[model samples]
Target: MIVLGVESSCDETGLALYDTQHGLLSHALYSQVAMHEEYGGVVPELASRDHIRRAIPLLQQALADAKLAPQDIDAIAYTQGPGLAGALLVGSSVACSLGLALDKPVLGIHHLEGHLLSPLLAKEPPEFPFIALLVSGGHTQLMRVDGVGQYTLLGETLDDAAGEAFDKSAKLLGLGYPGGPAISRLAEFGDPLAYKLPRPMLHSKDFNFSFSGLKTAVLTVVKNHEEKVIANICEQDKANIARGFVDAIVDVLTAKCVNALKHTGLKRLVIAGGVGANSQLRASLNEAAAKKRFKVYYPELEFCTDNGAMIAFAGAMRLQINPDAAQRDYSFNVRPRWPLDEIKVV
Candidate 1:
């Protein structure tokens, strides 16, 4: 079956064509990072409008690049929830309309599920019953995955998401918007011990995490720097601060993941979401995995963020489980919020 997936969950507009036989044929993504950069964060209204403008052309380009027509697409899969309402509406409306016009099945896929299953799209895919660490801009979570559509929430953030903390704190430091990468780069030169930021909930027996305190800790560091009590932070100090912040986050994340593994007895770990792109986090996790001798899997960098290939693959998997779910004569509603465990596939 051929599935066309559309993703407009946040600041990204992605379209992709996936064929079960040949794999992902073509995919396109347009990031609104630059548009939101000046605003220091995403503006919902602008993000929605941009998605409206980019979806169609991107879909057309994806289909053309795949050397197929709309009719060739067997189903349309769109991220249905847990994102900006307007942005989700754009993709949902377009996907449903296209599905109706083409007489193809339309599946409303959960955004987090798309992120969770992304690693499977890579050359090295983890087997069933693995733990997934989903650290994105809006969410930071740990889950036990028995299989597609079978996810058990292990733990999650009680306050700010990891990526959100990164971006917001970076802004406070004048690192600009979408600061994860920039801050991460600067962190490479810094000493993790220089700043000694707090690692919130690192010792929590449960899987739950808390980054709010960590954000406050960053604020305190910056505040002290401004008062001249600590003097102007040198380039090395800035780097060291970055390193400490990143390290604190990574430490908490790693601890929770390790705990989740022990709790679930799952030896394999799959990391997903935008923060999975962090070089430091990846290195830290990789080193831990090596010492623990536990396998770890990561999606290709492009798939690490919101994209359509995972949606397409997920839609394809759902359809394979129940072919009857492929009827698309009528429109379907998009879900802005849904629980991963509530979904049961085959």
Candidate 2:
């Protein structure tokens, strides 16, 4: 089956074509990061408008790259929600319209489910009944994934997610927007012992996570630095603080993941979402996996963020498992706040 996926959940617009027999054919993504950088965060109105401008052209490019026409697409899949309503609408409307035009089946996929299943796109995919750590900008969660749509929520953040903590702490250190990468990069120059930060909920006897306190700790540190004339803060200071923040987060995340694995007795661990791309986190997890004699899996870097390829791949998986999951009806609605546990096998 040939499935075309559209992803406009937030600041990025993505389009891709996936062939069940051939894997991902072609994919294109246009990030609104540069545009949103000026505002220090995403402005939903601007994001929605950019998606409108980029979606069609990206779709065209993806099709051209795949050497196929629009009619060749047998099905259309779009992220139906758990994102900006406007952004979700852009992808949903476009996908349903395409399905209607081609008289093909259309499926509405949960955004988080797309991320959760993305690791299957990797060269060495994890088998069923694995643990998934989904750490994204808007969400941080651990799930016991038995198979497609068979996700049992292990735990999630009570407040700010790990990615949000990274971004918020980066901003406190005078870093620009999309702070996860910036903070991670700056931490490379930091002395691990230069500062110490709190690791919230690290020992909480549960799979749940909490980063809000960690972010607040960063704020307190930044305020102390500002008290001594912000200009007096040196580059090394920023790096040190970044390192402290990163270490704290990594520790909490790693501990929780290990705890979850032990609790579930699952050896295969899959990390998905943008924060899963963090080098520090990966290193920590890899070392732990080796020491624990378990395996770790990750999506290709390209699939780490919000992208159409994951959406298409997820949709294809759903269709493969239950062909009736796809509907001929073009009407659709998006869920900007859908929960992953709510997803069920068709």
Candidate 3:
């Protein structure tokens, strides 16, 4: 089956064609990161508008790249919720309309599910019954995946998500927007032991996490340094702070992951979402998993962020598992918030 997927959850416009027999036939994406860079955060209104402008062109490009006509598309899939409503609408509207025009089946996919299923796109995908660590800008969660739609929420953030913490911490340190990557890069030069930071709730028997305290600790350090020194700290200080901050987060994440695996007795781990792009987090998880002899899987770096291929792949997988689940109706709705476990395959 050839499934065309569209993603417009936030600042990205992505379109792709996924063939069950041939794998990812074509994928295209346009990012508004540069436009939102000046504001140091995503502007919802601007992000929605850009999605409207970019979705169609990207869809056309995806079709062209796949060398397929509209008739060749067997189904249409789009991110339906848990994202900016307006941005979600752009993709949902276009996809539903196209499906209606072609009289093809349409499926509304959860944005997080796209991230959860992304690892399946790899050359050697992890099988079912794996633990999923979903760390993104809007969400931080750990889930147990038993099947296509079988997900049990193990734990989640009590306050800010991991990616949000990364960005906010970066901003505190005068790093640019999307601070995760920036701080991660600077962390390489800093000493992880230079400034110790709190690892909030890392020892909690429950899989739940807390990062708000860590952010406050960073603020306290910055305020104290500014008050005593009377001027901004040197680059080395910034790097050290960055390193310490990253280390605290990584430690918490790794500990929780290890705990989750121990509790559930699951040996396979799948890392998902934008924060999965973090070099430190990936390296830490990989090294720890290797030591424990647990298999770990992650989507390719380019697929680390939100994109269409994952959505298409997820939708296709769902359809393959249960064809009756495909929606043929043109009516579309955008979900600003939806629970992952509430998702039913058919």
Candidate 4:
């Protein structure tokens, strides 16, 4: 089966085609990061408008790359929820419209589910019954994944997600928007011992996480520093703070994942979502996995963010698992705050 996936849950406009027999055929994405940079964050209305502008052209690009026409697409899938309402509506409308035009079955895929199952599209994917650490933009969670749609929430953040901590802390350090990469980049030059930030819930003995305190710790350091003024803090000082923050987050995440593995007795671990692309976290996880004699898996760098390929691949997997999941009806509603476990198979 050929599945065309649409992902416009946030700032990125992505469209892709996945063939059940041949894997991912083509995907095209346009990120609105630059557009939103000046504003310091995403503007929902502008994001929605850009999606409306980019969706069709991206779809055409994807189709042209795949060497197929709309009729050749066997089904359509779209991220249905857990995002901005306006953004979700734009993708939903575009996908359903195409499904109506092609007379194809349409499926509303949960956005998190798309991220959860993305690693399966890797060349050497892990088998079922593994642990998954999903660190997306607003979500930081650990789950026991048995199979497609078979996810058990193991733990999650009580307040700010890891990505939020990154963004908020980066703002404190005067780093530009989309803070994870920027802060992490600056962290490389920092001395790990210069500023030691707190690692919230590091020893909670439970799988749950909390990064809000950590972010606050960064703020506290910034405001209470004995050195230069906030605006006058040197680049090196900012980098040290960034390093401290990143290390703290990395240590907490790595420890939690390790403990989760020990608790679940699962040897294989899959990392997904945007924050999964963090070099420090990946390195920390790899080191732990190597020492503990377990395996760690990750999606290719491109699939780590919001994209249509994961959605399409997830849809194809669902259909392959149960074809009835798809619906011929084109009418649909967008979900702005859907939970992951709510989609569990009965």
Number of the top lDDT candidate: 4
Candidate 2 lDDT at 239 equals 94
TM-scores, all candidates, are 0.96, 0.98, 0.97, 0.99
Candidate 2 on 1-346: residue-level lDDT in tens?
9999999999999999999999999999999999999999999999999999999999999999999998899888999989999999999999999888889999999989999999999998999999999998899999999889999998999999999899998888889899999999999999999889998988888888888999999888877875565456799998999999999999988998899999988899999999999999999999999999889999999999999999999999999989889899998888999999998875
lDDT tens digits, residues 1-346, model 1? 9999999999999999888888889999999999999999999999999999999999989988999988898899899887888999999999999988887788888898999989988987889989999998888999988887788888888889999889877876678988988889989998877889999988878988888888889888887785554345677877888888999999988878877887777799999999999988888889888888788899999999899888888888888777776666556566667766677665
For all candidates in order, the CA lDDT equals 0.87, 0.93, 0.92, 0.94
Residue 152's lDDT in candidate 2: 92
Instruction: Give model 4's TM-score versus the native structure.
Output: 0.99
lDDT of 3 by residue, 53-136 (tens): 898899889999999999999999899988998889888999999998999999999999999999999999999999999997
| lDDT by residue for model 4 (200-247), tens | 999998999999999989999988877647788988999899999999
User: After best superposition, candidate 3 residue 61: deviation in angstroms?
Assistant: 1.1
TM-score of candidate 3 on Cα atoms, chains taken together: 0.97
Name the runs in model 1 displaced over 4 angstroms.
226-232
**Candidate 4 global lDDT:** 0.94
